[model samples]
Target: MPESRKAAAAMSKTGQTEPSAPATETSAAMGGSQASPKKVSQTGAAVEKIRSRIIDLTIPPGSRIDEPLLLKEFQLGRTPAREAINQLAAEGFVKILPNRGGTFVRKLDLAEIGEIVVAHQLVENNLAQLCRLDDETLADDLERIQTVYRVEVDNRRYLNITELNEQFHMRMNQSIGNSFFHDFAQSTHRHVRRLLVHLYTLESALPEQQDEQFELNVRQHDRIIEAVRDKDREALTEVLPEHAGATQDRLVRLLQSNTVAPFPVKLRPLVLPGN
Candidate 1:
């Protein structure tokens, strides 16, 4: 984007995000933990574990999140649990209701998916196109990132694969030297990571199918990385939409399937309320 255009776009989305809520006190504050290796709750480890659980879909979208149960299960104190839940809410994983308690991660319906694609395309692609990557060393870093994602694909587990995928894209955004889009893209992508993982989690897949899919994803990353390395705007532009389209289709189907469950809080019929 031209200098003026980038500024305008940034200004327009300035008010889109809000700060997350504060967390309650952790239980460990009362008594220190004794469990060494397996035990968590050292220092925000609870938070990290909860975050990981969400990414891994151990706790699927719409799954009920009872605080006390979580506390007992994770062996965390009130403060840490509160903080983790608050952070999860902030990250768009769980919805904290006034009286009903916290719910599990939320799904990206058609509308949210549309919003993501539009946001990614506008901010990410534009910044990428405008990026000046004359530095070959940066290309090396990208190649390393691509390598990591390849491993992630091979693993086919929800947690690490999706996390690495997000990191890969975030690194690409960061490389552009545009802090505004870089940060926004990272945060925006965070909210959608759970479903993205659900979309591609390896479930009863044949070796051949998994290998081909992983190969395609790796090649896609390579193409994008190469474009960035060469500062080829056309290649960057051509690859992103194509990549997102396949991703969108995959995600939509994944959400529609049973591989990654959507934890629908208080499941009910399809009746429109108050109809």
Candidate 2:
């Protein structure tokens, strides 16, 4: 059997079934107009498990991705294992190095967090301004997403919280009716979500404070929804920065509290020429 087929068989034995391939690929494989679910492919399964570990910091930032171990753990063959790594690299979750440096989880940069926040805020604000509130359904969609977000926050499901939060923002961005802005907002929102994964994980240690902060986020989402519903550009412009800054502020507090000693990634101070 082919390597991919062998990998698929191995994965099926382990119960980690692969997701269906895209419709185009399925149709082409079947050699007919009708498309059916493809057999479990180990590649997608490996990618998802590895990506989740990286995001949840289970793999830890900057840690080498062990291919042999992954193959054994996920019951993936060589081809599928490498394919999963390449897919992760494409998603910016893993870094591939030349000259046999080996692939590593992408490190979270302290300095880049601030820049990401700025970019996210800029994109979100612009998208909000451009959004057409003529569609009442847009506000309804946002409210629906916000409801789920609040539940995730209250439940302390960090991963779910970040994912739902991203959905909430992206739903708003979708109203802009401009693909360019929507895409830009998507990329920025993803960066923020990844960064928030770390922030939320660290905050998890402090139950009282974590609950308070999460409630604040819930309230902010509510405010954003109200702004969108009322078509209040000014309110959105003001609240959006406050919402973005909340994450930055929490990160600062986490660092200052000395609770995150040794930090997950390296930290370096920026130096200017004169200084």
Which candidate number has the best TM-score? 2
Which residue segments of model 2 deviate by more than 4 Å? Answer: 1-42, 262-275
Please give, for residues 1-275, the per-residue lDDT of candidate 1 as tens digits: 24433432443354111111101111233344455544343425676667667766787666777669667898777766776777678767678876765565665555555666555545555655665567556666567555645544654555555665675666555555555555566666665566565555543344464455567777888888888877787887788656655555554444455555554432222221343
The number of clashing residue pairs in model 1 is: 9
Write down the TM-score of every candidate: 0.67, 0.74
The true-versus-predicted C-alpha distance at residue 123 of model 2, in Å, is: 2.7
What's the CA error at residue 88 for candidate 2, in Å?
1.9
Model 2 gets an lDDT of 0.68
Could you tell me the TM-score of candidate 1?
A: 0.67
Q: Candidate 2 on 1-275: residue-level lDDT in tens?
A: 24444543454355332322222233354464232233134676577677767766778888898678777888777777887888788767778886657988877776667667677757755665676767688777677666555555655666666666776776666665555565567667666777888888887788788778888888888888898889898888778767877876777778876778655664333232344
Regions more than 4 Å wrong, model 1: 1-43, 108-114, 202-211, 251-275
